[model samples]
Target: MTKPRPPLSKELQLRVFRRDKWVCRWCNRPVIFAPVMRLIESKVRNAGRVEPLSYYHTHWTRDGAPLLDELGAVIDHIEAHSTGGSSEEPNLATACCRCNVRKSAASMHEWAKRPQRKPIKGKYGEPQHWDGLSALFVVLAKRDRSGLTASEKDWLRVLAGATADAR
Candidate 1:
């Protein structure tokens, strides 16, 4: 059997997201950090309780949080990982949940089979500042400190530093 794949460090994932400006490389759509969507959905003003689509990777067609399921950000392999691509930053790209699942480990040949994605034309042009809703995530995460996982605490420290640098 092939050796089990090691997880990519969260820091590396963030780097790709940053480099791509929180836009999906494939479709040029703005992407939101998935966990941030979850937090928003859990609020009383939204769904009052975490909906199944919010956390269970059930983002296909839930009505309550439309974008939550479809535009959630994820790191994707630019080169098909199933075909020997390494998880190095150079081989990674930021993709939305829709594109990520659709592009799953597709080789260049399979990719060619899919329709080419043209950059979307919007009246406002490309977004000037998009952090994948990461700043909002930090704010919510700060308010829910006790709920943070170990890695989230690490992210808080890292992103908190980035946020301070921006001001």
Candidate 2:
């Protein structure tokens, strides 16, 4: 026989809401439902799998409409809770539904580390921004991974953390 589910307390509900800023913990989309207690329960139930059923409520439009007029994409937990993961911004990522299902039960770090082709050469002779934001997007778009030099990579990493207002 299955064990009875525990009731979610008001305090616990508030904690989850506050922790997520009353938004969908994965996509950062605001949830329309009040209390959001029910949504939390659904996510917990489907927690272990890569594709949780609860995602529809969080990632989808408030009226249950599809994102981008389709299922949109998948939301992934960079670190699984089973291995002492925290539900924080750094640990969440967006993936396509197909990719998420394909990576089920696999370690996220291992899955993300797979080798791929490098990005193509840029039309601009040099990275325009010198700031990290522009470089980071270039890093994300390029396939050749070989393009950016080590020093450039280091600079981009440092710049990403720099304040926009900083000179």
TM of each candidate vs. truth: 0.78, 0.27
lDDT per residue for candidate 1 within 129-159, as digits (tens), equals 9998899878987887776667667777767
List per-prediction Cα lDDT, in the order shown: 0.75, 0.39
lDDT per residue for candidate 2 within 1-167, as digits (tens), equals 32333443333433343344333433333333211222333445645655434323434443443332122333445565445555455555444333444444456676567542232344655332222123333344232334444543443344344455321
Best candidate (score: lDDT): 1
Worst 10 residues of 1 by lDDT: 49-58
Model 2 CA lDDT for position 68? 20
Model 1 residue 110 CA deviation in Å: 1.9
lDDT, model 2: 0.39
Clashing pairs in 1: none
